[model samples]
Target: MTAQEAEDFLRTYRSMLKTWTMAVAGFSNDDSDLLYRQLEADQNVLADIAISYPEKSYSVDLLINSRSRTWAGYAEQRLPRPQNRQS
Candidate 1:
């Protein structure tokens, strides 16, 4: 997406930040990755937006990216299987 389109995304995303966040939390690993890939694909535009909104820069895709990364981190973390007991 172009920088302008990215701007539009940010505007809309801000309005839905809370809902998007909840949705992200419930997303499966694959789904989370899909969203992350979509966002990361426009990293350049996001970075540009960062420059434009320095005050709340973190509110840009960085916020979502961080959450996506958190999802990935949790996805990689799993409890170990129980060992079999001796007879």
Candidate 2:
């Protein structure tokens, strides 16, 4: 993928993550689980983007890693407590 394409994908996934997170906050248990799964899938897509674009991997890696930390923190605060969380 070109750098522009990588960036576009990153932006899309980041938006999806944020939207799903908000939806999860008000969803039923089953719905929340589904949204969480989608969020994880989006994360995988971000990883894939990094791997698929070696030419832009450095910037992509940095963007993905930074957003990951932010996502984790936001999810922790916004989502319900997990039954099987690991430290």
Candidate 3:
């Protein structure tokens, strides 16, 4: 993929991951498995793009890391009482 395409793909996948993570935070038990599968698929797509375009890998990695940190913070905030309060 071209640099522009890779950037666009990364942006799209990051947005999707954020959306899915929020969905899971709200009510995931009903379709947790499906959501997990979709998340994995999106991640795989990002990895493929990075591999196919080594020149754009740095930018892709930055995007992935930024999203991951955001997701981790959000997830931490949404965790249950005991989980969130643990030392």
lDDT digits (tens) for residues 1-87 of candidate 1: 555666687876544443444445443334545555555565566667787666546667555565445443333354533477342
Report RMSD for candidate 3.
6.6
Per-residue lDDT value at 82 in model 2: 79
With a 3 Å backbone cut-off (N, CA, C), the pairs that clash in candidate 1 are: none
**Quick one: best lDDT, which candidate?**
3
TM-score of 2: 0.45
For model 1, the stretches where C-alpha displacement exceeds 4 angstroms are 1-7, 12-30, 61-65, 72-87
lDDT of 3 by residue, 1-87 (tens): 677777888777666666666565653334534655766666766788878988777866775674456344334457564645534
- Compared with the true structure, the alpha-carbon lDDT of candidate 2 equals 0.60
Ranking by TM-score: 3, 2, 1
lDDT of 3: 0.64
Say which prediction, candidate 1 or candidate 3, comes out ahead on TM-score: 3
What is the lDDT of every predicted structure here? Answer: 0.55, 0.60, 0.64
Off by over 4 Å in 2: 27-35, 52-87
Is candidate 2 or 3 superior in TM-score? 3
